[model samples]
Target: MTTTPALLPPDIRVFERGWLSSNNVLCLGEQATVIDTGHVKHASETAHRVGAALRGQPLADIAHTHLHSDHCGGTAALQAAHPDARVWVPEPSLPHVQAWDEDRLTFGDTAQRCARFNAQHALVPGQSVRLGARDWQIHAAPGHDALAVLLFEPEHGLLISGDALWEHGVGVIFPQIDGSDDFDTFNDTLALIERLDPRVVIPGHGTPFGRADGGIEAAMARSRARIEQFKAQPAQHALYAAKVLIKYQMLDVEAMPHAEFQRWLDGTRTLHQLHQLHRPDLDWPAWLALVLAPLFGKGVLRRDETLVLDGA
Candidate 1:
């Protein structure tokens, strides 16, 4: 595994990994806390690394910005290793954690994506928690997920923004993609983050970045541009869907046959494109024509008068 350099001052350490996992932060003080553990696949390694960083300081708490599998996957392992550690999670997600809903939590489908963890305390917005000697403020950030929240240290001007914000974009505006997302809610949440005016941001997935030198503004601009582009072209949504599937499946496009690809799409919600385009009444041929025609014309998919993998 490639190692990410320590980005924060001596007090804070970051364990940066790839997309399947989030960067973990170790906040050292009288009471040490870890923010957002990596996915379950990497939980053991993450714990080891975090243990080394603690250097005998008890890991007093394990906190999460949201309930996403990747962000809290390692919580169980870390807590198990450090039996005295208290696990903190957003108040809205507390019920989900208590019930441990495998299906509702989407854990059954993404087991490889996250590790299981137990919640010991609920962290609410406007609430304050003492980490070391400093008090960190919790703010509700509900765009990425309705339960998502962020951490802000007013004195340090540092923000631990989970999937709510990223260097290039935000988390999959899940509600939008799932056809149940509320754009208005997402916009309101974005505005809330903008108002925070954080000097430094430690996102859920990327390297720690500064608000200075136009970093935050640039990221916000990129997010706005993506929102506009997505609104203009619905197919961009499908493209992202495919990208996510590829990442989740870890499939090599070159090795997949056209028939297999079609089966995969059929089994997944991609088949719902017919409903999305308001052509639900169309027959299979008509639906295939409606769906594949534009993609072929756009050179995204190639068909030699037969459903063969492009370039095959």
Candidate 2:
């Protein structure tokens, strides 16, 4: 975990992982707790880190902000390591997690992976939970993911913001790809954050940002502007979403044969849904070309006759 003493409370330790995985927040307390394990690819490392941090103490709970693959993929691994650690997920997603339904969880549709795990409890909004001697109020954060929740520690003005609020912007509005107009909900979540007025924010994927870095208000303003841009040019947002999916795949594989990557792209339902909804005039091949154009142009990725390589 990186040490950013000025931005974080003494009890919280943040693992600032990059794009492929969500940051892991380790809360030190009498009852040890780990919030948001990273991607499956980093499961072993995550468990090792948590175990080292525990210094032989048993992990009491493993909680998630949401059930997105990157955010919760390491849950199964952690559960295996600490059999008694209770796994908790958002209330709305408890049933799906209990059933281990990849389809219902959107893992299958997004072409992402999350090993099955059991949830022993739900993180419902309007509730409070204790971690590391601090009481955190759980609030529903519904823009990036409808079922997502944020943990706010009022005493220190600390917020554990998942993908719902990031330094740059929020995560891709996933429901949009599935034919849902959730932009308004996303804005509402932003408003909720404003009301919370946190002193420091621990985001899912980046370094913690707070009053020193243009403050939370500045971040909110940037995100609001981005939302308006997407609203005005819905097609642009679709194209951005397409690029994100492709880039995520690239990050997962690092490099893949062009044919294999194409097959995977063809199999991902979200990409097809985005294309059909936004650019139906073009045939599949032409639409794909359009999606790949900027990705290749800006060196976010590179591909030759035989392979696709991650350049970003």
| Clash numbers, per candidate | 4, 0
Top candidate (lDDT): 2
What's the CA RMSD of model 1 in angstroms? Answer: 5.2
Estimate TM-scores for all models. 0.79, 0.96
Output the number of the TM-score-best candidate. Answer: 2
After superposing candidate 1 on the true structure, give the runs of residues whose Cα lies further than 4 Å from its correct spot.
1-7, 108-113, 251-312
lDDT of 2 by residue, 230-297 (tens): 88987878888888889988887889998898899899999999898679999988999989998999
Candidate 2 segments exceeding 4 Å error: none
Q: Which run of 10 residues does model 2 get worst, by summed lDDT? A: 1-10
Local error of candidate 2 at residue 24 (angstroms): 0.6
Pairs of colliding residues, candidate 1? 40-115, 73-115, 175-181, 176-181
